[model samples]
Target: MIEPTAEPAVEARGLTKRFGSKLAVGGLDLRIEKGTVFGFIGPNGAGKSTTIRMLMGLLPMNGGDATVMGIDVRQRPEAVRRCVGYVPEQHLIYRWMRVKEVLWFCRQLHEAWNESLARELCQQFELSGQTKVRHLSKGMLAKLALIIALAPEPELLILDEPMAGLDPIIREEFLETVLQSFCRGGRTIFFSTHMLGDIQRLADSVGIIHDGRLLVHGSVADLLSRTKRVRLALERDELPAELPQGVIRTWRNRRECVLTITDCDSQKVQHLEDAAQVRVVEVLDVGLEDIFKDYIKGQREAI
Candidate 1:
């Protein structure tokens, strides 16, 4: 038996995948610590699903290696699968099956199925155990998928856009449930989503990817401190012709300009205001969405 403390919940080294002429995932290396929520932020068609599929052994890797729970995902995929709970971006259950049937099938396949856990999730999510998969609403279906993923009680959970089209209340409930599950320790979650608000509220660390490349990965506080959003109240109508080195994005309005600095110190921010001959009316903290935008813009400029 592999020792429990030997490896991270998920680790990928030089992971690459390609589709025809386009490279979907490019030589990516990832490490997800146990008991942490790692958010994957990227635009549509940025190879987020492709990477997750390869890790789950649903798709073959063109290059590199990945492991889940100390088992090689490519060589011993079944063992890796047994340790992972996955909620895909799209529904993957059989429409003809009833809720109970689906859960029973999962119970047969996974050694870690917890019947009590499934029942509790179903009750909390307000799902009908007897309802057929085809008859459930979109939110109910999403809830079912979550329950299935949690029922197994796997060591790691990989969710792709788990909050796609649900009501705000349901989304909050789902996030709370995930947090509750993680409280026990030694369980990790890797979630990919466009919902920046939920990411901000829940993520322990974030990884930003753009055009098949990772731009930045760090704690939320580290990212916020490294990036700045400054609103300058200027006497003049236009920004300075020469700007600082770390300014990533800038937008100008009448007698005012909002500047985004990617790598900024307090002195640099002060210098920018002074150089523009403006008074800093407000220097608000940057949110996850702003950081994501700056990261994408930086990536585009690099290409």
Candidate 2:
């Protein structure tokens, strides 16, 4: 059975990493609850990979602590590795190893390896035992990597941009495998990706990172319920210095103003309308991608 607990699947406190003059990750503190599919979204070079590498113990943390499956990752990386499966953005396996030889080597490392599942996954991914790792296409290599990770039946799975370069069809195939196998087993999945649609389809929770910091983190449903895009048609051309409550950002042209706001509900919108003496033209629902873009737009535009 999947063995998550009250202690959380993953936790990091004040985790920091630096490269000489540059700070790659800056004091990130976050948690992933048991049995969750948590999506990590960030802009390019936002330190997503650095953070994941630190968590997996592949790289050292410049400061702070991280734990996976209740074990200190920095101190007990083997313990953490035993319980977690990782799919990186690119293939990292030895190219000279034959497909089955690689599988055999991986199988010997973990006590929990399941041969039946491995066999089944090979079939699902259309991989053959005779093919060398170098011969496998990118999509097939991804499948191979995923199968190796899953065969150990890890309680937590970490995927860092696992779909990065795959064409749409291959991406769909990989996503389907994750949904059917990992999600079905109650394993906690923490994956970082630029593909917001993947998060929309698979994540129970979402966290957005920008400039080495988490801008927002929460349950996807709750976040969606709390934020909105609003348009107001006002009698006055000039907006009041003190704008309506809940506004995050606002844009105005003549008699109309568009606002992005949080904690937005029917009551809040009604109150804004009544207080401002303006007509509420539209209250639009937005998906995760819109929210992600909105959060980063200001940070980028500032420069």
RMSD of each: 3.9, 2.6
**TM-score between candidate 1 and the true structure:** 0.86
C-alpha TM-score for every candidate: 0.86, 0.91
Best by TM-score: 2
Q: For candidate 1, lDDT tens digit of each residue in 1-303?
A: 123355677889889988998999998888777777899989998888898899998899999999887789999887777788889999889999999999899889887788999998888877877899999988888889888888888889999998888889888888888888888667888999999987888888888876666777778678877788878887778676677777767767898887778677777776776774775546768877877887677567556
**Residue 155 lDDT, candidate 2, scale 0-100:** 86
Q: Which pairs of residues collide in candidate 1?
A: none
lDDT (C-alpha) at residue 19 in model 2: 95
- As for model 2, its CA RMSD to the true structure in angstroms is 2.6
Q: In angstroms, how far off is 251's CA in candidate 1?
A: 4.7
Q: Which residue pairs collide in model 2, if any?
A: none
Residue 219 of candidate 2: its Cα lDDT? 82
